[model samples]
Target: MITRKRGAYTGRNKSSAYKDLVWTVATTKDTTLPLETQIQETLQIIDDNLKELHSNKHQIVSAQVYLANIKDKPVMDEIWKKWIGDNPDHWPQRACLGVDLEGDVLIEISVTAVADL
Candidate 1:
């Protein structure tokens, strides 16, 4: 069976889980925030979502990050590294890309993790 968390839109749920794996994505609701704040907020949302799905950052297997500006990757990378912590084992395989996002949104992140259950 699949577990799903509803999203703001009808066409899609925020995240879904099946068996051992849970997938989720997040963006800051307030786009006016600075890039660093946006990344921090989005990651916090991801943290919450992961816990709701019975997992944590350490369980994340992979991640995909989208940025409105490729030029900001250095900034994004710095924050991401801090968030992932110093444990090498906890770092997930991650890829980031510069993409045109909707509205003032500057950053978005998607993650997949294995649930403890």
Candidate 2:
């Protein structure tokens, strides 16, 4: 079965114990917020939507990040570490790169997670 929520989409099996979730990012035109702030807010949006599916899940399996400026990478790295934590075992497979993000945005992150069904 498949389900869509505010920030995440999920595929589930009633008899199975796991569900796959895809986080959807929000796009905005306002550029006044700091890059790190935007990243944090995006994560929170994903979190809020995930609550409708399962609330106790914490580990992410993979992530893809896009940044409008390579110059912002250092700053983004610092904030990402704080948000995703520093544990090696818990770290998800990730790919980050500088790109022309939408709406002149500084950054965007997409995550995939497996959670209890």
Candidate number achieving the greatest lDDT relative to the actual structure: 1
How do all models score by TM-score?
0.98, 0.73
Off by over 4 Å in 1: none
What range of 10 consecutive residues in model 1 has the weakest lDDT sum?
A: 6-15
Name the Cα RMSD for model 1: 0.6
lDDT of 1 by residue, 1-117 (tens): 999999787998888999999999999989999999999999999999999999999999999999999999999999999999999999999999999999999998999999998
The TM-score of predicted model 1 comes to: 0.98
Off by over 4 Å in 2: 6-18, 21-23, 26-30, 55-57
Query: What C-alpha lDDT, on a 0 to 100 scale, does residue 29 get in candidate 1?
Result: 84
